[model samples]
Target: MISGRICIGLCFIALAMQVSSAMAEVFTYPALRSSQASDPEQSLLTSTQPMAVIYGSADIGAFVPVIEAFQQDNPFIGVEYHQLQTLEMYDITQSQRANGEPAADLIISSSMDLQMKLANDGYATSYQSSETDALPHWARWRNEAFAVTQEPAVIAYNREFFRENELEPPRTREDFIRLLVNHDELLSEKVTTYDIERSGVGFLFLARDERFFPGIWDFVRILGQAKVKLYSNTSPMLEKIASGQVVLGYNLLGSYAETFTQRNPNLGVILPDDFIVVYSRIAIIPRGARNPDLGGRFLDFMLSIKGQSVLQNEGNFNPVRADVPPSTFSSLIFDRYGERVRSFPVGPGLLVYLDQAKRQRFLRRWQDALLNRR
Candidate 1:
């Protein structure tokens, strides 16, 4: 009887081990427990209950108000948000699905190219509603990827420094280039911008800039001449500007800059007069989503006028919907700057630079110009 009992216990252990392995494969704890997961301020997954999982590049702080508002209307649906880098979000979504495992129900990212690639590759599930239908022609593509926020790439500078130094901030690309050329001594290492190779959104901005401005490479070489500092994220550059460490940040996210400017009155933002490049954060429902219906519902909610208000007022994010007036900062900027707002269109054109060989070539050219290697 003792031997029989011991055998039964051994069998139970084996079964438990198998179940643990299966759970690990299913949940992918490493992805969930990313750096953002540990920060209570960054994650909304406090409850142990089942919830719709969202993988996005936006910070959790900005999402809190939107999520809370969503929950008010959707009491039955809980939300689990994981903030990951733009590239990581794309890679994980692709990898998890390729491995035949469930990934996040929703994927939100600022990398338009990557998001477009996913949809083109059939990774996104079709979703549509009245809200989606109302989106502008340039904002939604094929009922797969939806642009949620309209954010521009703007220039941020230290207002105090500009005032004290009696220097006028650059309002156009020509003015910006001239500033760097003329004030090399004062601006040396004082200007910071994104390191495109490391930042997906940065790459997108650079790509758009190149397409919009023919002499963009010459400007890049000028940045190299000025000994510009580089960073992978916008907040750090904004922080540096706010603290007087850096005088200016180029091609910074307008949404984040607006938020930072509110807190730091000394910071200034400029929507370039020559032209402004606008980007929209695209959201997609992954093909392997555990709950596509819930994802669709959330997606619709995000596109709704109600959700857009929460984003503009509470989240400090620009709304994508045009009907949700009074217009957000994007519209205000466009109005003030004239009709130079070059908003990226949600279509196949975004996928051009995403090709492996083409991407490498573009990066190589970027490195050469930034390094002053001709």
Candidate 2:
């Protein structure tokens, strides 16, 4: 039988095949699309077709309701969204542009580092408007890439398990290390976290932790000794927790966790008090976009009060705009995180961990503890 970690990889491959097939077909048309990709199922053909922007968001489905609201006003303008994996979208944009092929009009991704790298490497267009101006300094870099959402990487747990054990939820990395150290036997195989080796966001979060926290390596060692399960994405990792296979999860997206609480009251989220990593979904108009003007209009509409509100209410997007009232969820995050919320800025700083030498060194260390333990 395959090892458990290898099984996780195979399972992730299957999951990706299911969710990313449509996106891959749209992006790689020559191989997959028939001559008659006329139907939306085949070609994403919708009525009022005009402008299209290929985006890279795992939760691209959420954009539908928000975009529909935008269409209500500009009925003539239709923004077709083509979603792809974050890294694939970035690499494809670069290759497509280099080969003189059409690329995305706008790129939005949760992998803020890849987006920032594209902008830093001169793949993004510089456009400033009231919309861009409204964003905080850290959220926008060089009038190019802009942060579109305010979300956190949080600790999610099976509420039922904690209640039954009468165990206090961890509120910091140190606290989590102690939890693992103390209950190593109970959590031996009942803990789950992102597999940084396979996941772009996971790599980013862990690398950022290494930068800010000196004790991150110790915590990783603790998790390794405890035999923590690793998953590539939030959806599947969280499913295991909901099903009681896993009792705790680390570095899960807070917004996604909030969505879980509605049906599974046993699923709970907590922002670390000592420090929490805040991630923003960054958006940028590609320098080679065919619909540059349309992209700008969409950005404006996204930042506009109405658009922002629609995103918050309809799409469940965590608002990045200061104007939007904090949802109960956001309020809780703010209340707990307080000044400990470290919003990693959207700029060259993100590119540091992407360096070839540095990444290899980081992974070497990661493997020394995590891979060896497994």
Candidate 3:
């Protein structure tokens, strides 16, 4: 008779094979129109120019290459980007729609719930990309929003500082507390992370932590004890780590970590082995877009290999395609120092409940535990 371990191994192998097969069956690349002429040169020549206006967050560095490549390919199309803060983007997009001005051609943001909000409010236009089959279900919304990049919030540390302090990165919530307690002097003020009270993305990160991990509040309390520096934005946290102003920080997005490491090779990223939350930055075209056709073309470009590669190289994001080869920095995904990265789905309903009141309540509690009480 086969042993239980043998049976489990077989089950995992079968599961992996199924997943691989499904990934293989997903959308074809370049996402050209099937109705168009079969001749590749003809299709390229006949492709419509993209005339789109994108409203996105200032934090989305991954989109730079996508925009550039799209413009280069469709020279006649004018693609303009309006960068705003998370809340500001939401307000402006809403106000623009309310004023009956032409809606933005595209919306891309790290604020997953807000993106879902736009989809639910009937503000987003739905056009399924041919590449949708390759993406995980959680990454695509009712064909309204498509996740263009997979980014995980992780711990980033300055390698030189870690070595100087004889510090090893935290592998678990408990380990994190232990390090804080023992290395108080070494860590001192050289640790930082997001202030959930002040940031929409930060609050979402906290909510996810609470949802996925039991005793997350207790974990927060440990961070309180550490007296870690907190920043309102993720960029500053990354900057601190890179400058060695802080040795380590939590809530650093994978994209930011990747970008920072390219410039500062001594920076290291660790995705915990037990539980790491992976968030996808998503894209959508608004309903009544000024240039709906251009928006569609831009969306196709984003899912293309060339566009995804820019995100991988410049913004430090994981390409959505399974066939894309992993880069040198990609090893961080499979590293042993942390928990397996788990994808977090931002359901449509999540946005309905994430109002300002609820957000404030959560942040108040978080601050009480991490800042006020500490």
Q: Rank the candidates by TM-score, best first.
A: 1, 2, 3
TM-score of each: 0.85, 0.84, 0.79
Clashing pairs in 1: none
lDDT of 3 by residue, 1-374 (tens): 11111111111111221122111111111212233558988988875543477767645354555655665676556555665556555665676677777877777877888778878888888887676656667778788888887777888888887787677888765677678778777776777878775566777777888877877777677677777888877778888887888888877777777777767888888776667777777788887788887777887887777777777776677777766676666656744423566665746756743787877777777877776444
Candidate topping TM-score: 1
> Could you tell me which 10 consecutive residues in candidate 2 have the lowest summed lDDT?
2-11
Over the stretch 1-374, how does candidate 2's per-residue lDDT look in tens digits? Answer: 11111111111111222144223422211111123345658565533345556566755445655566666667666555655667667767777677776667778888888899989999999989998898878889999999888778889898888999899879889999989888888889888888887678888888878878999988888888888899877887777888789989988977677776676888888888778888888889998897888788888888777887777665556777788787776776666566887777888998886898988998889878874563
State in Å the error of residue 149, model 3. Answer: 1.0
Model 1, span 259-296: residue lDDT tens: 88878998999888888888889999999898888798
The true-structure Cα RMSD of candidate 1 reads: 11.1
Q: What is the lDDT of candidate 1?
A: 0.80
- Model 2 stretches with alpha carbons more than 4 Å out: 1-48, 372-374
lDDT of 2 at 331: 71
Better of 2 and 3 by lDDT: 2
Q: What's model 2's TM-score?
A: 0.84
